[model samples]
Target: MGQAWRDWGGVIGVSACALPIVVALVVALSRWRQKRGVPARVAWWRSAAEIGAVAGTLPWIWMILTPGEGPRQVHLVPLRDLAAQAAGDPGTAVAQVGGNLLVFAALGFFAPIRVAALASPLRLAVLGAAGSIVAEVTQYALDLGRVSSVDDVLVNALGAMLAGLASRRWWQDDVTRPLCTS
Candidate 1:
């Protein structure tokens, strides 16, 4: 436990400190929305979803953007890095895959709840891909000593889609609409 804390103390500490503020913000925003004539239930869900998205996602983004000691690398071929990882140590592969999947999970899980425009699994997947691309580009441009792999985008987008599916019950009403006519 101590070793785990030492390894992740900063992220843990910041998340701990932010918990109270997040709660207060949620309450204040919910009340403000109510004062503005929004239904209490609707306002609470929207406020909580919005805040939860940011609070849950930012730490992962921060960790991804952090510079590493290794030289920067890029992998344009999709699934190549993924296959390599799959063949590597089990722990490393799981961590890499799981971390990538979780990177935008909160956004996927909450965005449709808060905004009707983002109510589809396809939309969530696209959004995740675009966001992942931007992060990969930033990593390369900043020489952050990280590997910018297409596999990351693929996994991230899939993860978002999966999370969106999990939250489909709470998505806006139109979320059930068909993806295509054909």
Candidate 2:
């Protein structure tokens, strides 16, 4: 855990500091447009969501892509090693599972709110899985001293689907009226 922090702390800290500013900027822009009688095509909340999603997710991505000081490893069998590891070290298991899930959670939670086409859980899951696959493949291809595993993709997609379900009430496609009535 300490090693992980040392590798990615700066990126995480920067992202944490930038998120509020990004949201604030989007809110201010939305208000400015509204005051000018120029109705927003996209909801301000959606804009904030998009920014937050990217800001929150990018640091994790950087961590995943950054090569460590060892040889790369690959785990082809899905969940086998994860299950073993869980049995051995519960704390590490929790952290790994939770971290993988969170990687794309913001994207899943916010994407459907911003784009009507992505409102379905299936779509969000596929999107999340695809993104995770790309990241895993990048790690393997780059020999980034990281373990590229199918389990990561599965967990990531599951996380995205869960987040999508949580945000179902605000899905853009579910709304009957325009976001801006003006």
Candidate 3:
């Protein structure tokens, strides 16, 4: 079980990071293709991307919702001495937190581009912030294997904002035309 969580964490971390972006791109591409009335090599790719993203994040959804057997235990540790000192490599903990934050950020920035948002970065930030809260709440409630941390929340928001800002390029007429037609 411990081994599974560890492996699953890595998988979730990666999927949570990648799936959002994939979903956004595929949806945009597919919508454009449909509008053009062409049935090229897109439907399969769209389905594959959507399925991959869903498959990747499902384990995380399960982990967050299922209550485990033991009573909950909360530990307070200084940020500098978390998973690393406890497991003998604080560097790893910091890296993991950073990675998770970026994952959510990418989701925040890209998801809007995929579905069309209010066209505001602030709105994107709010969406990202809300998502972070949900994940944190899940960790707190599940008490299964994930630690609810403030650093994680901050990192996630940072990622979302960055992604949102970067997505500005997607709105440009030149890029949009070629990407949609292709």
Total clashing pairs for each candidate: 0, 0, 4
Which of the two, 1 or 3, has more TM-score? 1
- Which is the winner by TM-score between candidate 1 and candidate 2? 1
Tens-digit per-residue lDDT, 17-80, candidate 2: 9867887877886777567654555446655666767876787798778887778888889888
Instruction: Write down the lDDT that model 2 would get.
Output: 0.81
lDDT scores in order: 0.85, 0.81, 0.55
Sorted by lDDT, highest first, which candidate order results?
1, 2, 3
Local accuracy of candidate 3 as per-residue lDDT tens digits, 68-132: 45555444443542345347656656556556555555455444444444246777667666776
Candidate 2 TM-score over all chains jointly:
0.84
Give residue 158's error in model 3 in angstroms. 1.2
**Which residues of candidate 3, in runs, are more than 4 Å off?**
1-90, 115-118, 172-182
lDDT of 1 by residue, 25-86 (tens): 99999999889777778778888889988998888788788887789999998899989999
TM-score for each of the candidates: 0.89, 0.84, 0.53
Candidate 1 has its poorest 10 consecutive residues by lDDT at 173-182
In angstroms, give how far residue 72 of model 2 lies from its true place.
1.4
Stretches of model 1 off by over 4 angstroms after superposition:
1-7, 173-182
